[model samples]
Target: MPSPLVVLSHLRWDFVYQRPQHVLSRLAATRPVFVVEEPVHADGSPRLEAIDAALGVTVLRPHTPVGEPGFSDAQLDVVAPLVRRWAVETEALGACDAWVYTPLATPLLDAVEPRAVVYDCMDELSAFDHAPAGLLDRERDLLGRADLVFTGGPSLYRAKKDRHSSVHCFPSSVDAAHFGQARPGAPALDEPADQRDLAHPRLGFFGVIDERLDRDVVAALAAAHPEWQVVMVGPVVKIDPAELPQAPNLHWLGGKTYDELPAYLAGWDVCLLPFARNRSTEFISPTKTLEYFAAERPVVSTPITDVADPYGDIVRLADTPAAFVGACEAALDAGDADRQRRTEAMRAVLARTSWDATAAAMGRLLDAASRAPSAHPPTPTHSSTPARATSTL
Candidate 1:
């Protein structure tokens, strides 16, 4: 029987359809995938709740007291025993591979001695607001213990490569068919009521509206171009609502289901990636970049190194609010010929990247690691080139 895989992650499996969901859903085809989430505080006895998301994909949430939701000592105490029992019972015939997205679950290393442990470093967690107290130290520990480490983008790989010898860069990829549905005649089904009345030449953004968002820049952009409508979608976290820049031209469309996104994309004149240049956003690869390209929409964004460096040819990048407004205007005034040329350029790039391709490459890496003999973990040399990965597609 194929070995089961348990993934401990900071991201909720049901939240947004990003890297974790895209990669693991495909992995489920070959092995049982149990996505273990952080504890959710509840009133009852500490117990595990397993929800079946699909065939071979299960979302496991440990519910303890309300205050014990994080990887606090109490939460760990409640989760360790339950998971240990399940891991052993499920993998009696084979050793399960433990894939970790957070080092907060390090206590599990003692409780469940998995055959292999992989750290998928998708973000610089320590830089985020309200980050756990010991995140960096725990990351260091995880680095030493992890058999393999994978970064979410090239910038992240560059930053973390010196810390671990096995780190590899797997930047964000797109689901072409899914996002490509945003064509001229595509139905924008399930359009949120508020978005229906929004004015056009809609300059829109969709994704978590967090601290990484450059609120001042957005406000300035709105101020400078009162005629152009600004639409902000997705949930707001780690920030207060009153703190957001208010303007008559700015519309907060709120969050929408993934299936409903294409409609919004189809209606948009241009897409926006307005992440602020901050510690939290320093290494972000912005999966939305590829998604927007797949949608065949012109995009304007801040100088996010990851997006600017690799995708600069297709994406318009600007540093200041004035520059951002100029880029938006340029995107708006793009002639048919200019638009067609850029569209073809984007398609050529998107053709090389897809969620299926990314997952297949990752599956190969995991299998290769599992089959290789265990050797003493090497110290980071910091200068090695990243390993190449490709898919048959």
Candidate 2:
């Protein structure tokens, strides 16, 4: 009989902007999976019902209230105790055969006595803007405690390999069947009347508008090519819209739900990933890269390490603003036959890098950890210290 498996993550289900849901869905097929998430809002109501419906797994949200101001020492203090208690309670609920903790909840997992521990390092948290201080230290401590560490991309794996003996690269993968539906002639996003009135060939980008975006590059591209309308779709994070320099041709479409992404992808002549070269963006393995390919659209990206790897063939890589603009021009100039060939190549590549494959790799790591000797040694007992000579009234 197989041992029960449990997954711990700090990310809430409503914040399913990441690929945890897809990974959880794959893991659920083999064993009982439980996701321990943070509380969604200040009200204490969990936003995990949709995730429960989607993954068929138990979703546990602790009742602890997040601290005031959201991002202070006070908040961390409020949340940490609750998270620790939840971890302890979850451990007591059953004898978990193995445990996989995503990066955010790694500290909590450290206190639990699971049979095996696997650490999933999906992102370099410390490099992110507004990340908690001492994040890297915490991650290092978690890495030391983990039986195995799994990274989301080659770049991340390379960065982390020196810290852990057992580290593997598992890049972001797409739901091929879902994304493949975006072939030309499929239903596209309804272009806004204003957008429709202005343009013919539209270059688009769809994802979170965060610090990782090279705003200067985007502005330059839009300004340089008045004929091409550059449409951006995603909610802004860490930056105010007013602060960003905008071009007349640039349109911000806000964000769309995951299910509606294919429609937006289908309508674009090309997809762009203009990431600023920084610690956070350097190791990122954007899930949208393959999604764009699956939609049969040409792609242009900044020279991020991971994107420049296996995707160099299908994705045109650029270093500077001028180079990126030139790449976009090249992509636009390419005939439909060239575009289709590249898309086919991308499809073939993505089929091999599926969520099922990622889950299988994780399963293997967990299995090995379950069999391997414990990395953590037992604590030694200490004799009581002699009482000091103290005067008490």
Q: Which candidate tops lDDT?
A: 1
Q: Estimate, for each residue in 98-179, the C-alpha lDDT of model 1 and write its tens digit.
A: 7899999877766667676788888898889878888788888988888888888888888888887777778878888888
Clashing pairs in 2: none
Model 2: ten consecutive residues of lowest lDDT: 380-389
Q: In model 1, which regions exceed 4 Å deviation?
A: 91-94, 185-192, 376-393
- For model 2, residues 1-393, the per-residue Cα lDDT tens digits are 334555666555555356777777777787667676654445663223213635446776544345433223454455556544655665534545434444545545533456777677777877888777666666776777777777777777778777777776667777877777677766656654444565647888888898999988898889889988898988887898897767788888787777777766666788899999997797788888877877878899998877776667778899999999999999999987888778777766764567787777777667666765474422211111111112111
Those runs of model 2 whose alpha carbons end farther than 4 Å from true positions after fitting are: 1-6, 39-53, 63-93, 97-104, 110-112, 185-198, 371-393
Lowest summed-lDDT stretch of 10 residues in model 1? 382-391
